[model samples]
Target: MGDHAPDGEPPPPEVEPAGRVITTDGLTKDYGAVLALDSLDIVVGEGVTGLVGANGAGKSTLIKILLGLLAPTRGRATVLGLDIAQHGEAIRRQVGYMPEHECLPPDVSASDFVNHLAQMSGLPRAAARERTADVLRHVGLAEERYRPMGGYSTGMKQRAKLAQALVHDPRLVFLDEPTNGLDPAARDDMLELVQRIGHDFGIAVLVTSHLLGELERVSDHVVILDSGRLLRSSATTEFLDSTGTLLIEVVGETGTQDRMGQALAAAGLPCWPQGHLIAVDTTRATTDRDVHDVIRDTACDLGVGLARLQADHRRIEDVFREGGDHVLPTS
Candidate 1:
């Protein structure tokens, strides 16, 4: 049973929640100067942490090194309080990994596959059988668990992989691109299952994805990587807070937006056009009330309707842009 501790199944009365599920010290990886990970130091606590980046951003490299599938050129790391270099096997026993690509054998049923892996993880035969059933149901594959892997849809294949990852009752899980190759509805379903694994099942999750916005709905904290380096690491709430840029749209005649932009610039508040809205830079301004009054008076003087006025917030993609790393918006 994946007794989501949050669901009235709190940790044992004798045990306190542990801290720092993962930590890295100067973690660096160099494939003959490519430098996949560059002096990266980070600590991951409980709950869902989103690792976001585009292709070649060292996300996969970092996960592989942490899982002991690959070694770093220099630096040390730990997972679940076990040193990766010395206790790689022990770490693997406590952590689960759902790889990004297809690895399921076509002939075997998902039930057989999960049960076999559960046994491989040291579960007793009967316990393995029981756990396999529990996890498959947990991942929404209970009804389809008997089907051959080759006959499953892309969404079902993803769920089966997730079921195997959870069959062993791991303390943490690494979900690499779990929503990949899914349509909109299937993608939403997969993301919800991932959130349940972390939130409902009480499993620490490190989910990596190129789709930025998807994580905002589920992740507790977000860590951004770009070009093999850390861009930003903070709570999801902080990233969604007001960015101090006011998005205002003035409606009137044809040249109203441009005229408002010019008027705001003349008033010493730097402004620019963003499609249909004018982005007013408020960093140099005194206060929100003052800025609001100024904009309101400017619109009144210009005889235009204040269509929209609200503070802007940074998106996951904005983190990269702010860090001077230009990339296409994946959301």
Candidate 2:
């Protein structure tokens, strides 16, 4: 059944929203002496943008402020062009949120819960039921949609949460760690669904996660936060670009790589361990020590044969390197 007016007329068709999905200017939140979010100024456009940080790094706080569930101490923000402080209810009506914590009822069936939420969002009972069944099937929960959620596994529970968020056909969604407890295969499946929501359905998405490398795959843009402050913000390809570093792999005894890295470091070559290979900075060479010369000498002194030497591309982990030059993306 389709949504209809009380006068027996069909409801107005949904319109696709345009412009920036979210924007904040000097958004900050604090609890007494502790600061949770610090002066966050960012603009998120369409597609998937990953809000990445550690557990206590204000990722959740930022989302709450944007959703108008929590107030910011000293800044302004807008969601879909409406001021959060003034149009909170209106904003919530057009946005779907999947929280990080478990909030599902033990005895409620997935079908019932999603259908009820759809009705609450202003759909008629018949329309809500039809929408719920479709959304549940889209999330891969069609076979077990009627089972009580308390008996579902972690992956199944996650699918149920996703089903509810999409039942209302919101223009935007905020998914807080949708892959938190899922296995590798489940996580991949969920990420694929997230991509489909953004690209196929044309819904703006802001997904949060603690893993930088994992999000880099699905996120169009990545905004990294550290200690409640903006660390770096850029497109996904910027993170994977080449850093002008040479990867040196060696063939030797048991601890050859570690010993080689230490020796290179002592020779004033900026080198670090990347898995079993040593990554040396080609740009950080000093006048006294020729970086390439030192590496050759070190390998000869240690009696380790240099197996490979080639330019290495930057990895997401380099974002945390102590002296890395993390350049934010230009608009």
Candidate 3:
């Protein structure tokens, strides 16, 4: 028997299954002649998993397919152990979604909008109203919940959208570019809220972003896509781990960084000046001759004060620029 009931029949009772929250196998989608998603096989567990890619990398397409808003050309997927092909409605009932584009009505107040959505999710009138208020407060829109959405700032509008998604008390949320058009502070606030949703409320979150580095702080795992293909998927810690490069900062006159770079290079250490700091290649450094000791001695010889020295960690972008087994072909 399938996970869901037959067509036109009511779905089976919703149940939270153990382990992976989402899994896809050989998922492919083509928009006419253009392939939007290639053969993608991924497993997403609990916590915040960041979906990262450049534009037109199939991030949105995958989200739509998972939500049952669009059908895949090939392969299958399951959310919370319910087949998306057979249990879309059941899956949607247990999951929340925040779309990338603006879909809010201009004249409606946030409170009313959220309340209506909560009721649609099967909450009673009183329960819907209470949830609306609770989610609005949680999203930092309690003070502006009564105002028309048209009058709300960009941050407020984003928060209102988030509030509606959470009003239903979903086990998972798919947030597509939740930090779209906000200032740095607002973006940080949104990220913090996303972290809270995953950590505090225990809601599994799948957040999409084109900006590679923005999700590093909040996401427990990251999935990278390139031109409709999976590039890499791993724990965020693995991406940010030390890259065997030592970042050395010297405190001295304006010419200090260049001088240190020259000294280190002359001392047989591969080093380069990197915007006020010098980066020393430590991949070849041996335990008998520590890279840190070499740097310290070089700085002392040049009479430059060492400001800071630490291992340079890799960023998500490095996986693209630096050739790695995890990287996919751009062509």
Candidate 4:
């Protein structure tokens, strides 16, 4: 069970009395020679959960099946507890979708497009326009909402796409690579907006992305897929163990790192230089006293101020590296 909540906080108990916003049992999809989804089983509830994998890892296949856009070759799935195979029209009414590829019409203004979508979702014309405007402003696209999307930057285009998805006030949203092609600052802004959508608005979000590191920062639970199979699924924090390694940052000349490495080794510590920093790899059995002694004497002998020494946070990439799955080779 993937029980970890976002940012180390406990998730609220399921609001739906029946529980499980989404579930799939033995869900399978095939493309001739390739099995896109191999009898995959999954469960998702309220709040934000990340679906992550490299391209062609069946992330897209799973989303398409869940959205009822593609029928599974075998097995079955339910969205909001309604069988997608039989209740696809009903499911689409409550589920908002932001597809991965670009689908916006270049000639239309975002305000017009979003308004049109809102109305299509069963809102009255007046209410659709109002909600469209609200959603555009919420996604930081107020200034450009009226402008034709063909001239808009990639970031602006993305915001326009997002505004359309939220215009319908969907109970659950499927966001596909919401940060795709964004610069660092824009990507951060998009992530914060995603978190806000799930937490502040109380909407269930199932977002998919290829960037493992960014997903780790925002998702409460992370599900990893490999070669169309479930490689691992668990709470994000659990994926990162509290390894007792201390990442020490010392400021000095070029040889300072080398000197510190030499000094720590000579002092009977199995320390090594890592890029511009030094890392003390403590074993599971190593005590706090062992780290303290290593840090204290090593800094004093090298005459380098401690600068900073804190427990190293294991990154999501580290887990994938250890899992021994290879990435698809590019042609």
lDDT of each: 0.86, 0.85, 0.86, 0.81
Off by over 4 Å in 4: 1-19, 249-270, 273-278, 284-307, 327-331
If ranked by TM-score, best first, what sequence of candidates would result?
A: 3, 4, 1, 2
Identify the runs in model 2 with alpha carbons over 4 angstroms from their true place: 1-18, 244-312, 322-331
lDDT of 2 by residue, 31-90 (tens): 777798899888888999999888788998899998999989999988887778766777
Worst 10 residues of 2 by lDDT: 1-10
Where model 3 places Cα greater than 4 Å from the true spot, the runs are 1-18, 248-278, 286-309, 323-331
Q: Which candidate has the highest TM-score of all? A: 3
Model 3 TM-score relative to the real fold:
0.81
| TM-score to true structure, per model | 0.75, 0.73, 0.81, 0.80
lDDT of 1: 0.86
**Model 1: per-residue Cα lDDT over 271-308, one tens digit each:** 89999999988997644558888999899998889989
Q: Residue-wise lDDT of candidate 3 within 1-331, one digit each (tens)? A: 2234448745654543675899999999989878989999999989999998877899989999999999999999999977888878878888899998888999999999999999888888998898898999999998888889999898999999898888889999999989989999999999999999999999999999888778878999999887888888999999888988888888988887888888787777888877877887877643357677888898899899998998898876676667554443221
| Residue 207 displacement in candidate 3 (angstroms) | 0.9
What is the per-residue lDDT of model 4 for residues 112-214, given as tens digits with 9 covering 90 to 100?
Answer: 9999888877788898889998999999999988889998988998898888888888888999989898999999999999999888998888998888888
Error of 2 at 68 (Å): 0.9
Question: What TM-score quantifies how close candidate 1 is to the native fold?
Answer: 0.75
